[model samples]
Target: MATGKYISYLRVSTSRQGASGLGLEAQRTNIDNYLNGGQWTLLKEYVEIESGKKDDRPKLQEALQLCKATGATLLIAKLDRLSRDAHFLIGLQKSGANFVAVDMPTANELTIGIMALVAQEERRAISRRTIDALAAAKARGVKLGNPDNLTIAGAERGRIAGVKSIKSKADVFAKDCIERIIPLRAEGLSLHAIARVLSKEGILTARGKAVWTACAVKNVIERIEGL
Candidate 1:
């Protein structure tokens, strides 16, 4: 039932994956299979080599713009390749452009919302499992922490360094989320609607809550714009 001009967007998480065709070929094959009997015109294909965690994707922006301007449907091999972030996906849903993931041709906003929640829970479970595993290892008389056998002061320094590293990564992620939020706001979505979209996408706040409020969304925007 897909009938229109189509713009394809493909993404690989790493440059190595892009170069070595680790996940690219499978995506291409899926797209091809989806388009086999469809009355669709393939406009252009854009490939992006970037982490899904970051939203500063130039190629993806271009593909979406093209779809908007040309009334073309944006096609991707998989939902995750398009984005793992719910906010980004929600923004796209509201952008007045059509998109179809070959892997989930029947997917709609509701299904995407469910998928995002599941994915978020899976990530949290993985982190918990890792922590539990480490605790169990320590209980088995394994000497954990400070593999180099540092002094107390050295251990404090290491802890400080680790906090800084985590902060740095968090800042980068915040900036990326802000980038997506700004565009959505500019597109005339109210803060509440934006928050709803983000929540539906299972995006977490700084405090790791899966739900968002208009005030929370506004605070993030203001903080990021101030920076």
Candidate 2:
């Protein structure tokens, strides 16, 4: 028996996303048109709501599995629509699926590899900048922490806790020992207090355990820095 032809994958980063944006609807519309345009057969369609920064998207993973199992080509509306993880994309490339990002018709393995490397480097640069900014803030005596650490009448504590979570990918851990002091410092609590409250409330870490530390918390904050 012949296997199915094309498999489609769609994703949205946040739960609040609508059914229309992020090219989700556009993909379905275009792929459907492609099928009817008389050259392709539709095998499966997968839709997921998860951050591109995280690796936990079940539907996307399912689509990849289907591609591997059936020897089908995976068609996506865009390349960046895949997760931001270079390692994950590289793994997919090794799986032998012919992936076509709708936006780039001539894209091939070599181009994809180069793109992944660039993405990884971009992430590293952002991380370096964040560290430098934090260090400078601390040097200037600015309180760079979550408002949860402040008292009703005293200065905020130096230590803070943060959590950076991607829907299904890597969760980094860091401790920002140097934080700048922000305005209204005493009016709000620091991240440490907030984390403590969360820990006491039994909020599990990204690894699904009950743990809270300054490094873990900092990782979470840094992960979502620009967004």
Candidate 3:
């Protein structure tokens, strides 16, 4: 059972939803269900519109500050209800406020199945990238059926260069996410759990995909290991 003070925070995408209390009531219901039998105090509830995506959410900051000052947990209906911004995540860590996502109470076997599905998607992405690269090369007038080893060697060099280019961008893009991911990983969160956390934080894969998959988390973990 939940015990301690909690300050509930809710969010919606547009001002219309916030004004109409369209999404807020559902969030309230979820929070109520989580605290149904718990001997806990619901200290306050704050609503914010988008974390501003620009990270301009005064309400989130206000709720976080209250949580910090009172030693209360920041409660929410879902993780994504919070900003999907990585900086906000980093700030939340620095603020020293605890939080609970009602919908994500714990991990389950379904996550393993999700990891497999994500892996399948990754394979498709690889095949798609290969096809795209070949088409791009054809457009650039590269001879596909070059009988000479020189052409083959040149193609190999292009492949390596392409790989380097993607890795460089991925490394740059993943910098902030790595900072958040490494600690969660060290603290014993499973890869899928980390994936869920990142997805909720609005941290996308290097390819800019919305959801983070276990394989994506593993790729970042491998990068950390390489470091």
Best candidate per TM-score, number? 2
Give the Å error, residue 209, model 2: 25
The residue ranges of model 3 lying beyond 4 angstroms of the native Cα positions read 81-83, 106-227
C-alpha lDDT of all candidate models, in order? 0.73, 0.58, 0.71
Instruction: Give the per-residue lDDT digits (tens) of candidate 2, residues 158-219.
Output: 32212223332342221111122122124474667646644553333444344455555555
- Residues 25-98 of candidate 1 have per-residue lDDT tens digits of 68878888888885879998777776866667777788989999998988878786454565456556666678
Superior by TM-score: candidate 2 or candidate 3: 2
Off by over 4 Å in 1: 80-83, 117-227
Q: Higher lDDT: candidate 2 or 3?
A: 3
- Shift in Å, residue 43, candidate 1: 0.7
Best by lDDT: 1
Candidate 1 achieves a global lDDT of: 0.73
**Candidate 3 structure lDDT:** 0.71
State the lDDT at 40 in candidate 1. 79
| Pairs in steric clash, model 3 | 84-201
The number of clashing residue pairs in each candidate reads 0, 22, 1
Give candidate 2's error at residue 224 in angstroms.
Answer: 32
